[model samples]
Target chain A: MTGFELPVALFLLANLAASLWRVLRGPGDANRLLAALLFGSTGVGILALLAFSQTPAATPLLDVALTLALLAAITAIAFAQRAWQRGTDPKRADD
Target chain B: MTSALAFDLLLAALLLLSAWQAMRTPHLGRALLAFVVFGLLMALAWARLDAPDIALAEAAVGAGLSGVLLFDAWRAIRNKPDSGKNAGDEA
Candidate 1:
């Protein structure tokens, strides 16, 4: 890795560490969910950077980032839909 | 310590802290949030370890998918009639 890459990646990791507190101490699920979302974007960034720095085939790694970005949104949407369904489904047997 | 090592150490500490909270918190909502945060931190950790492939997978599968699943579960539980009766209990 380049001289600068190491430090940049390290700083990103440190910030991620701080974010952990919010996940642990959040008052509600909304906070936690947002934290997880934050992770998705951050991970993509860190991965893209590392890929470009360390690997020759950095192009494919970008696909991973793109997939992550797309999937993260899908996950949030799916959860919202399920939650809405559960909220509206009065007849859910298990409750 | 070198900057990289210091960063790694900080990431490690935070990962442990968040994981602990995610697993141990009494409030389900807070626990879920912690879990999501933990996943993200884990992705970072993987990147630091020089495994971008794993990092990407962790971000997409672990953080993205798991966070949604946990929140969905929380919402379902919260919306239950009995849950309303015990709404005062945040846990």
Candidate 2:
């Protein structure tokens, strides 16, 4: 990897670190969930960078990134399903 | 070069800070968020260390799946009858 790659990676890492503030100081669960989404996106970025910095054999890493993106969305959906279940349905309660 | 080393050190320090936040946060929602953020940072660190496979896994399993689980739990709690005023207000 070139010297440039490391600095760029580090810069991304720093931003990830800054995002932790939302997680720690969350007044609500949604904030934490948002942080999780950020993690998925940033992780993909880091992985892509690492793969690119490596030999041409880094193709497998791209697959891994794709898997991550898919799973992240699924997870969000699953959580929403569970959270909005029958007993907990806010709309019902409001009615 | 020396600059690379500096970058690594800075990243490591930030990771540590985020990790601490994830573990120590008082509110459940906030704590979950912190942990997710921590996972993302960990993924970035892995990439920096030249392990793209690990970065991807961490991003998906650690951050994504775990985040969903946490949010599900939060929602369950938020909807509980015992949640009462807070739940009503928050909702």
Candidate 3:
């Protein structure tokens, strides 16, 4: 199981790198924000895999992963409530 | 061990890329999103360095709080009626 951890973590990192393209080419603000959401979820998985990969299993990293998950949710809520609108242009704010 | 090194190198590269994108991107909203991505990647770097405490702090304060604060600033700038005209003079 430990042998597979690093590879899986690397795969997730690749997932993150791919998401950056979406962020770069976003024709809409919502598309860019979706990439950020992808970062949050993938980051959690990377953290969890790293936590278990160590020989002694640094369990505190699990707590960090949990915190990241909660914060990701909060960040999404804040984005939806405060920054995003239904039909705003990427270059200009309607309000 | 080589794979571990590879993971760290990739994380470091991504971290630098995100940080650069956050600063160099012309669009304020996309730049802010890049900043959030940088923070998240920074947290992972900290974890890889065997510093869980810093990882936790980076996750909470860097990715979470900073993202919201930057968004608020983006909104304020966007809402300003004469922001574009005064862009050069305001700073």
Candidate 4:
């Protein structure tokens, strides 16, 4: 809508792509979870960017962001816990 | 016009670089550290983008809460025997 919003949109998209790459290329569940967390947080940031450009004065976006942030943590914990419970394979697949 | 865009772009690049490095690092311990840095820098980026309130929330949750969660997860997993073999394997 204004000069600032365009680049914000592009940055969010670029980071999202980057996070997706990590999600796919990750060697382990921890790596994938890391990417997933970053990916989700960036999405929340896009929402914040929307709030900033469109509302400009509202404070509710912070609430939304806080909620997303907590959820990301919960997801990370769940994934990492699964990784732990499943027992890591110290051996390569070829072996 | 171009300067602001350039600066913002730099911040975004910083965010991506730190995040990717964190995920790519072989040592899970180091990766957790990188995540903390990413959290802090991203919070600053929020301020650069003219969102102080978001910056505050980001710094608190992103940096503080996420950092703690990462370390807790790291502690939960690192002492286990298999992280050594888990580094580069596709899972």
Best candidate (score: TM-score) = 3
Candidate 3 residue-wise lDDT, B1-91, digit = tens? 8888889888889888888888886666667777888888899999999999999999999999989887777666656777754322121
**How many Å off is the CA of A59 in candidate 1?**
4.9
TM-score of each: 0.71, 0.67, 0.88, 0.43
DockQ, per-model, please? 0.36, 0.41, 0.58, 0.05
- Model 1, A16-75: lDDT tens digits are 656656545544344444654666677677667656655354565676678777876776
Off by over 4 Å in 3: A86-95, B84-91
Report the lDDT tens digits of candidate 2 across residue range B1-91. Answer: 6656766787677778767766774444445555666666676567667677787788777767887777777776676777645543332
**Model 2: number of backbone collisions:** 2
Cα error, candidate 2, residue A18 (Å) = 3.8
lDDT of 3 at A25: 64
lDDT string for model 1 (B1-91, tens) is 3866776787788788878877786655556656766776677677667676887788777777877776677676777777764432334
lDDT of 1 at B35: 72
Of candidates 4 and 3, the better by DockQ: 3
Off by over 4 Å in 4: A1-95, B1-3, B81-91
lDDT of 3 at B73: 71
Candidate 2 overall Cα lDDT vs. reference? Answer: 0.63
lDDT of 2 at B7: 63
Q: Indicate the worst ten consecutive residues by lDDT in candidate 3 chain A.
A: A86-95
